[model samples]
Target: MKDSENAVDIKLIFQFFMCCLVAIVFLSSTYLEFSDYAQFQHKLKNKNWVQKTMEITPQMEIEIFHYRNHQSKIIFKENQQEIFSKSCNGQLELICKYIENHEIQIISLNFYTFLDKNTNNYNEFLLNTIAFKDKQGQLQTFPYMTDAPNSPQYIAEIKTEFRSFFIFAFLKHLIFAIMFLGFNLSFNVFKKSTIKLINNLIITTFSLSFISFVIRYFLL
Candidate 1:
C-alpha cells in the first residue's frame, strides 16, 4: 500500500512538470506572435518607412521626387529593376492637394502590405501613402492613398485597439495548437502503452509549440 501511494505521488509530480512545459510553450508561441504584430503596428503609427520597406522588399530601393508645383512621385527599384512607380496626381492626388494648400509637409513616402502570418500570404505592398509633418511638426501617416479597388479598406482607417490584435493572435495560435494535436492523435503517434492521456496531451502540446517556434523564428 505504501509503494502504491509513492507511485501515485511520482506520477503526479511528473504530470505537474509536463504541464509546466506545455504552458511555457503555449505562452512563448503566443508572445512571439503578439510581439511581431505589435512591432508591425508600431511601424505604422510611427511611420518607420525605411524599416517597413526593408521588411517587405529587402532588395528594393525607394526614391522620391518633389516637383515645384507641390506634386510628388515615388519610385521603387531593385538594382536597375524598376519594380513600381506612383505619381501624386494619380492615386495620391488628394495628398498633392493637401501639400499645395500647405495643410501638411511631406516628410517621406512609404509602402505597406497587410501580411497574414497564419496563412503565410500577404497583399501587395505598394507605395501608395505619404508620411507628413503636420502644423504642430508631429509626424503623421496618411494611409491608403491608392484608389485601386483591390486595396485593403482597413488601410484607410487608424487602428488603436491592441487588445483586439492580441485576441486575434491568441485565437490563431490556438487553432494551430488544435490542428497539431489532431494530426498527431490521428496517427497514434503517442501510443506508448505506459503513457497516460494527460502525458500524451502534454507531449503533443510541447511538440506543436516547438514546431511553431521554429517556423516563426525562421520565417517571420
Candidate 2:
C-alpha cells in the first residue's frame, strides 16, 4: 500500500489539528449546556406548585421557558392548567373557577404564551374569589395571594418571552464550526500555511478560532 502521508500538505496538517480542537471545544460546551438543560427538565418530571392564575386545560401540554436576570434558560413541560397556576399538577380544574369572577392583580401565574411570533403575552391574573374543595368534596372558591404574606422569601414571579431552546443549541454548533475552521488555518499562517490566506482578516480569524477550539477541546 502507498503511504498517504506523501500527499499531505502543510495546510492539511494544520487543519487536522484545528478539527481536533473544534471537536473538543464544541463537545465540552455542549456538555455543559446539556447538563443545565437537564436540571430544568427534571422539575417537570413530577412536582407541584400553587394555583395562582387562570385554569389551564388538562389536555394541553404547556411548554414553559423561564429565566430571570442573566440566568440560564429553563424549559418546563406539564399540563396547561398546572403550569398556569404554578401548581404544575396534571390538572387544575379547581383554580379556574376562582379566576372567573374576581378582581385582583399580581398573581402567581407566570405562564406566558405568544399571541404571534412577535408578541409575548403574560397573563398576570389574580382574583379575590377563588374556589377550593368544600367540606362535602364540592368546589369551594375563594380569593388567593391577597393576604399570603408578602415576605422576602417569597420571590416575585414574572413572565417573559423566549426563543426556542434549539436556537441556543444551533448557535453553539455554529460556534464550534467557526472554531474548527479558524484553528486549522491559524497554525499554517506566516509559514507554509496549511490554510490558504491572501488576506489578513481570514488569517486572524482562523488563528483565534483555531487556538480557542484546540485549547478548549484538547487541553481544557
Candidate 3:
C-alpha cells in the first residue's frame, strides 16, 4: 500500500507539471498577440490622424520623414515641389514646434498612396502622413504629398517601428508561476482510477504547449 501510494503521488506531480506547461504557453501566446495588436492599433491611429490634415489630389505623391527630436523632411513630386515646397517647410516647422513644446517623441512615419482624387490619370497622386507620439501618450499627425522635383523615397525600417512591451514580458513570467502553483494544487484531488485519463490529458496538454510555442516563436 505504501509503494502504491508513492507511485500515485509521483504520477500526480508529473501531471501537474504538464498542466503548468500548457498554461504557460497559453498565457505567453496571448500576451504576444496582445502586444502586437497594441502596436498595430497605435500605428493605425497615427495614420488616420495624418489623413485628416491634408488636401489630397490624385496626381501627386508625398513622403514625410521625421525623427524623435522634432526634425523632419518632406519630399514632394517634381512639379508639385515648386508649388508646395515653401508651404511644406512652414508646415513642418509648425509641426516640429508643437512636438517640441509638448515633449513628444517621433517614432517613425509611413508613406503610401492614400487617395487617387483625380479620375483622370493626370491628377492621380499619393498622399503622405507623419505619425508621432507625445509625452501625454497622444498621437500627432501631419500630411504632405509628392510633386515632380522632390521624388525622394523614405523607407522606414520595420524593426525600429515597434515599441517594446516590457510590462507584458514581465507579466508573462508572473502568470506562469501562478499557473504552476494552481495546477499543482488542482492535481492533488485526482484519484488513482483516473490515472489513464490524467495521462491522456498530460499528452494533450504537452502537444498543445509545443504547438503554441512553435506558432508564437517560429510561425509568427
Candidate 4:
C-alpha cells in the first residue's frame, strides 16, 4: 500500500513538472511574438523604413534592352520571354517596382548579369540593396534596415544600443517593471508574494545589468 502511494506521488510530481514546462514554453513564445510587434510599432512611430531582401537566380535572363545617352534600361527574361524592365537613372541605384500580393512595392536594386562562357547563357546575377527614401519620405539605409531576411545583423542597432550602460540598464528595468505590473494585475495567486517577487526582480535586474557590463568590457 505504501509503495503504491509513493508511486502515485511521484507520478503527480512528474505531471506537475510537465505542466510547468509547457506553460513556460507557451508564455515565452507569446512574449517573443508580442515583443516583436512592440518593436515594429516603435519603428513605425519613429518613421523608420521596413524593406524586404531579394535574391536573383540563374533562371532569370537579363538583357540591356535600351540605352539612351547616359541612361540604360535592363529587362529580365525567363523562358525566352521578357518579364520586367528596370530603368537606371544614370546610376546603379535604380528603382525597381514590382507587384506583390496585388500591391505595388518599390525597391532600389542594382542588377548585374554575367554570361556563362561555357553554357553561352546569362547564368550569373548580382543584386545590391541601395539606400533610398520610402513612400513616407523616410530614409532607408543599411543601419536602420529591417526585414533583411536571413541576415545575421538584422537591426543591429539594438545590439549597439545595449553597448551603452544607460540604455541597457534602463531597458532591463523597464521590461521587469512591465512584467511585474502585468503579473500583479492579472494573477491573484501572485498577490501575497508581490513584495517577494518585486525584490527578486530588482536583484535579478542589477545582476544581469552588471554581468552584461562585465562581459562587454572584458570580452567584447
Regions of candidate 4 where Cα sits further than 4 Å from its true position: 50-220
Ranking by TM-score: 1, 3, 4, 2
For all the candidates, what are their Cα RMSDs to the real structure?
A: 16.8, 14.3, 14.4, 15.3
User: Which residue pairs come into collision in candidate 4?
Assistant: none
Candidate 1 C-alpha lDDT tens digits along 149-211: 232343233233344644555565565556444443443334555335644675676567556
Could you estimate the TM-score for every candidate? 0.31, 0.26, 0.28, 0.28
| Tens-digit lDDT string for candidate 3 (84-203) | 322325546665555446565554444442232345222212246567676788877655444211222221222223224334544554555555545544555667557556555655
Q: Write the per-residue lDDT of candidate 2 for residues 1-220, one digit (tens) a residue.
A: 2255434555576766766776677666755655554443333222232233444334544332324642222122354233332432223333332232332211223221212223444332323343444445565444434422122222222101112434555566566556655554544334543354433454464456445533443221
Q: lDDT values of the candidates?
A: 0.57, 0.40, 0.49, 0.48
Candidate 3 off by > 4 Å:
1-53, 56-156, 159-174, 186-188, 191-220
Candidate with maximal TM-score: 1
Q: Positional deviation of 129 in candidate 1, in angstroms?
A: 12
Clashes of 4: 0
lDDT of 3 at 178: 55
Candidate 4, run of 10 with poorest lDDT: 96-105
Off by over 4 Å in 1: 48-220
Name the candidate that leads on lDDT: 1
Count of clashes, each model: 0, 16, 20, 0
